[model samples]
Target: MDCQGQTIEVTEGQSCRDVLSQAASGKTLKKSVACTCGNRLVDLSAPVPRDCSRLEPVLADSEQGLEVLRHSAAHIMAEAVKTLFPRAKVTIGPAIDNGFYYDFDFERSFTPHDLEAIEKQMAESIAADKPFQRKIMSRDEARKFFSQQNETYKLELLDELDEDEVSLYTHNGFTDLCRGPHVPSTGFIQAFKLTSVAGAYWRGDENRPMLQRIYGTAFADRKALKSYLAHLEEAKKRDHRRLGPQLDLFSFSDEVGPGMPIFHPNGALVRTILEDFETKEHLRRGYQLVRGPQLLRRDLWEKSGHYQNYGHNMYFSEIDEQVYGLKPMNCVAHMLIYKSALRSYRDLPIRYFELGTVHRHEKSGVLHGLLRVRQFTQDDAHIICRPEQLQDEITGIITFVQDVMNIFGFAFELELSTRPEKSIGSDQDWDRATTALHQALDSMGLPYAINAGDGAFYGPKIDVKLKDALDRTWQCATIQCDFTLPHRFDLSYIGSDGEKHRPVMVHRTILGAIERFMGVLIEHYAGALPTWLSPVQAILVTVTEAQNDFARQCASELHQAGIRVQTDLRNEKLGFKVREAQLAKIPYILVIGDREVQDRGVNVRFRNKEQAGTKSLSEAIEMINEDCQEPFKRGGMRYSFSN
Candidate 1:
């Protein structure tokens, strides 16, 4: 065996902890959460085989160690809750991204006060520093034990297990069923916080009993936990749900529907700008604009495999005794467009772009403000090309994503998602599609993580997730290669040999959905979008009623110059108007006081409160226009300007 370049002989049945302790000599080994034996992550207490080639330490501060710490923290939290509530039944608890949550069945709801009490109890348990011991028993023994203790949830879980044996981790006389790689002791949980509580149906089934879920996060130490808490505070302040109403950008109403959002004048302005930008950008890239109906015949969806693989998430209706489905995707319509006429190889790479709105039957419980909604418009596009053109098309889409994200000042990562369990497609087609995406990323020398079993039903895809200001990732772009759709729809083109050949389809979206992208943009920029994207770029303010005419003239000039300018000429204090403009996050505040009226110039106060010396009206307009130019055009892409 090798331990950090040092060779050592391991006897039969020697535990990883034993070998690690000997290798470290006088150094402390307790910080190691687990050791990787070959490719398998094994607990420190697990027996090491004689043939194990190498041992690598999983430090508490490492990724795997954090998962172990959070998992153990969840168990400790459950122990505290059981001690305090006594009758609360514990179910499944797992470590998730950024945190952990444990579901419990209790007689009543858990209040914020209960969370505090449970936290205090957890602290006491951590102070005791009890060692966590793992024991294996037959499924029957575990069932009998839980049954005698009246843990019906545990018995139910056990009954569903197919394995003959199971593992239980116990600490401080509290035991839970888990396949765990927990911390060595309870005290190893250096920092943790119980975040909140919510109601969740058992296993996410609405028909099942409702359970109380406690959410929490854990880190290696206090500093990491404090940093994470600070990020959470910033995220809360930037939450689009709060900022949307505060800025009067958008709103959700009971009258309209739960997941449907109504955009006000200000919000509509932003959406219109985004859509216009999408149109111009796609046109510049040689994509033709297209439109499709909101609903399509159910037979078409079944032929496209959406009915079989995506019906559960689709909304269907019976019209004129025929079943129809609200379009959840724009690909089917685009395929029909390709079939509308006989195509030749000369038009192989035909790109169709649309601002297509779609609807999905999202569970009410899962619907979020704009992030997860029922109806949203996608900046959807489809490219039909020959087999040889797949790589170049995918690369071009990746470049388009980079260019668009750059315009929005976003840093993003790419991920390749493979086939899902409930998807439809031939194995050969799936493999080919996956391989094409892999080659595209490789050709560009871009690194991407693979997301197993999470692709679109029709094909594998490359998902682009943008990192916002707070470093939170949001899914916004995708590039999918589909070989099945064209075959299913019999979309064909004439080759040089005058033979009919199936065209390869590429489905992609630069900005995934207008609503979700807006939500992300709101939070990413903290409601202070760049001048070009801001709903109101500048506000014209007068010191008093005397300068109202001058402000009006200035507003008209700015407006004629294609600027979204508003006038604030109320009989109010200058400071009051300035404060209001600042709160609205207007990029520029043009103060037209008596001096400005006399000089025919404007005093500019930036949103960040930086002052710009008075400038002539023409100068101010030119500067604002330059700042308002879209980033891509500013980067030297020629575009015709219009209001």
Candidate 2:
């Protein structure tokens, strides 16, 4: 077959390395980590097949090669663990997005010291440069081999395999059951570090025995690994769980039940500001604000196919012998509202928006502060439009998401999710809905990845993942197209032909969940929110008791100008008050002193400790008001104290 416009033929016994070496005509192969024969990735040592059409090298720094390197590092880690604890049973070890993890069942939990010792052993093994050997054996032989060693987890895994033969990889004395195309030797692991250890139930089942999962990361070289570790350090500093309480944002209480956060006064103020912004924006976009009940009849959920597709993640109760479920989504209520009235062709596109609170039964292990909670508020909206107007409606939602994300200073990527296995819609319906979403994305020249079989049960969706300051992606916004919901709810509108036609439904959220979005926002800005979003935009501090009255007057004027201002008239030092205001991340500190009272102006200090000099009361108010404008209307201008 042709490769790089060259015709090359190879015999069966020749390895990929030999073939590539011949094809290269004496060029070095040090940069090549692996080779792909057709669609399958294989090690350089693997024999070339006669049927191979084209062969290409996988570079060490490429995405696929990084995965291979990480997987190999995981095996090396397992070997090191086995060396330290012979009785430890290794389960599955897979490469994840930024790293890799290996689960092991030991008599006791592994400690920080154990991790260090394991790392030492891994380094030693890598220095030895032991080759990884792969072997295939009959299922019975593999079972007997693992059973003899009393590796019960491996034995159990072997029992579940339907294949008559299985593959095993061995490095020096350690062996593991895996289907792999790992690096040639342990020495290939040039840079790696074990990050942490956590408890995970076997196969994620709580009833099963708990296993100690060790997480680690590997990169092509030391520089990349060092950069990643630095980023991780920054991420820890920006952790919302710690910053939330430090900044008096939100809290969780044992008595209040897990996964339910109690937003303190400051937190509530931020929430209210965000909700108010959402309301004004929605109204400006021609959306009507609406509210729905917290719970609905179980039959309604069943009819919507949620009971069958998402019941495991739902909470249910029996009321008056009729079962009911807490709303895990806002679609049902919006659909009910749409069905409550008939619509004419002129009203084909009716948008309803809600800051709706929803509850879902999340496992205790997965509940992370506000990021993953049982009860949270969602900026939910549903738009019902004619089939002919589906594409335009979807396009409008995409534009809306871009505008909102820009206001938050977030960069986002989009993904199109197709129908899942348990989805209820007809193939034709799914196809049409998926086409409309694609058309919208394509029309805007937006590039999106496809997440196959991961859509909501009733519809296809576009997931918008926002990137924060730490460069981590959070799934915040979504636009879903549902043909089945209207059909299930029997929702329709009169067409120009005077005939009733089923109106298509589009489910969307600009900020998907208020709790989660706030958490991301807190971490994104490191608790120093923009002036417009800050709970207290400014604080008034009087230099002396003599200036207290003037400080209060200044605060009142600022408040009247729509700034969230508060005055500190306590008998505290001016420096102390400034420090406190800065600690609270207040955007501006207005200092009123004898000189300022005489001049009828105030000295302004920003949260970043930059002084804005003295400004007359009216000038200060005007500058503050300009900074307080919502970011969307301000053309995506970010917060700057200098401004």
Candidate 3:
């Protein structure tokens, strides 16, 4: 067998660990949790396959290698849990992006104290360095063994297995059903921590029993773990749920309902500015503004396939013996508008834009502040073009996304989503749609990952995830290529040959939702919005009653200059007023006093602690105008929303 680019003679039954121990490589066997034999991952202690021809070490620091360690950590954690609370039944535990989690069925929720005890138990197991032994058992035998322990979840899992044999991993007297290549032993779990606990539904089915989920993370070394913990602390400080109300942006009341937000005047102003900017940008890109009703006839939804595929998440009401579904999307009405007119090849590609509000019956368990809300507005648009024009239209949308995200200084990743098991249209149409989206991304030199079976019910799509200040990703933009909707709606256009040809539809959004983008924007900047985007851009503070008149006049001049400025003439010290403005994150705090009254100038202080020397009113306005235009330096049209 070839090991680490060197050929070595191997015994027929030699284990992977035996080969690793003798391989001449810089990566020590101690730093590896698993090894790859050809294309398959295998545990170090597992015997090599009879036909294996090549082998390589999987380092503990790589992304996939980290996942292996995290999964091992999860198994060790489950062992500790079972040891402490024998009555606690364990279910599936797998490693996620950030860490790992294991669900337990118990009578009560796990507390912080319980987590500490569990950690101590896990430490003991880790110190013992027990070997992780694997075995393959027949389906019947596995079911009977789990039945004896009263592990009903395992039994149910076994029942769904189509394979005649299942693999089990056992360590330190505890066992779990898994298809895994775990670390050589418990000793490999070097640096780990159980972070927090929450209630989760079994199998994510709300009707099923609720279980306690313990979340944890692991790293190759203690230093890495410490750094990650510190990052988590910083994330907690920037959480939007805490910063929103404190900044007087938005709030939610349990009495009103869950998943519904009440925007304060400040938040409303911010939203208006954002939406207005979107409107101007869309218009500049050749998109016509449009509107759609909140409720559409049920038959219309059925015709568009939304009622059939997404009925479970939609809310329906009866009006005078007719059923109407609250719009979960805006494409249906946009398509109706297209069908209302006769089209020619000259009018092949028509883009309709709308800031449409939609409603969906999201589960209570998954409802987050603004990120995952039931009622929100989407910056939605639909493009109808001939088949030959599909690629250019998709490319145009990609450019539009790039322009908008660049304005906000956000970097993004792209993904291509394919058809799902329960999707509309024929296989041929789905393939054509997927190919159109893939080719468009390829032509633009944009790289994207494939997200199989995660597309819309009617078509395939390209999803864009934005990276924020914390290096975390959020789903913000999408461009879906849809061939089924137009065919279903019988949308057609006159060709040069005087024949009726079908038009294709593309549904997309620049910012997925206003509320969600705002949430991400708030957390991205930590509530210190840019000068142009801030609801209150500046505040004028008066030193004494003598300068009140001057301050008011200055405020009027600034306001007349199209600045969002206000005056603070309350009976308070100038320092106190400035401090309050800073706390509010106002971009500029202009101070006026007797000297400013005589010289006709104002002192400028920025929220970032930068003090600009006294400047005349005209100069300050120019400074603010320049700040507003900075976002457009990325090659977008100049339109200041602050006005």
Best-performing candidate as measured by lDDT: 3
Order by lDDT, highest first: 3, 1, 2
Clash pairs (backbone) in predicted model 3: none
Candidate RMSDs in order: 2.0, 3.0, 2.0
Q: Write the per-residue lDDT of candidate 2 for residues 488-592, one digit (tens) a residue.
A: 889988888999889899999999999999999999998999888888888989988999888888877887777888889989988999999998899989899
lDDT of each: 0.90, 0.89, 0.92
| Per-residue C-alpha lDDT of model 1 across residues 603-643, encoded as one tens digit per residue | 98898899898989898888787786656573455323455
The per-residue C-alpha lDDT of model 2 at residue 369 equals 91
Q: Answer with 1 or 3, whichever has the higher lDDT.
A: 3
Instruction: Flag the better candidate by TM-score, 2 or 3.
Output: 3
TM-scores of all predicted structures: 0.95, 0.94, 0.95
| lDDT tens readout by residue for model 3, 1-643 | 8998778888988988888777845456768888898889999888888889998888888787899999999999999999989999999899998789999999878889999999999999999999888999999999989999999999989988999999999999999999998988898888999999988898889999999999999998899999999989988888889889988999999998999999998999999999999999899999999999999999999999999999999999999999999999999999989889899999978999999999999987798999999999999999999999999999999999999898899999999999999999999899999999999999999889999999999999999999999999999899999999999999999999999999899999999999999999998998889888999988999989988999989988998888999899998988898988988889999998888889898998998878997889899899988998898788646857645
Native-to-model Cα distance after best TM-score fit, residue 258 in candidate 1, in Å: 2.7
Model 2 ranges with Cα > 4 A deviation: 1-12, 23-28, 542-546, 568-577, 634-643
TM-score of 1: 0.95
Clashing pairs in 2: none
Badly placed stretches (over 4 Å) of model 3 are 544-546, 572-576
Summing lDDT over every window of 10 consecutive residues in candidate 3, give the lowest-scoring window: 634-643
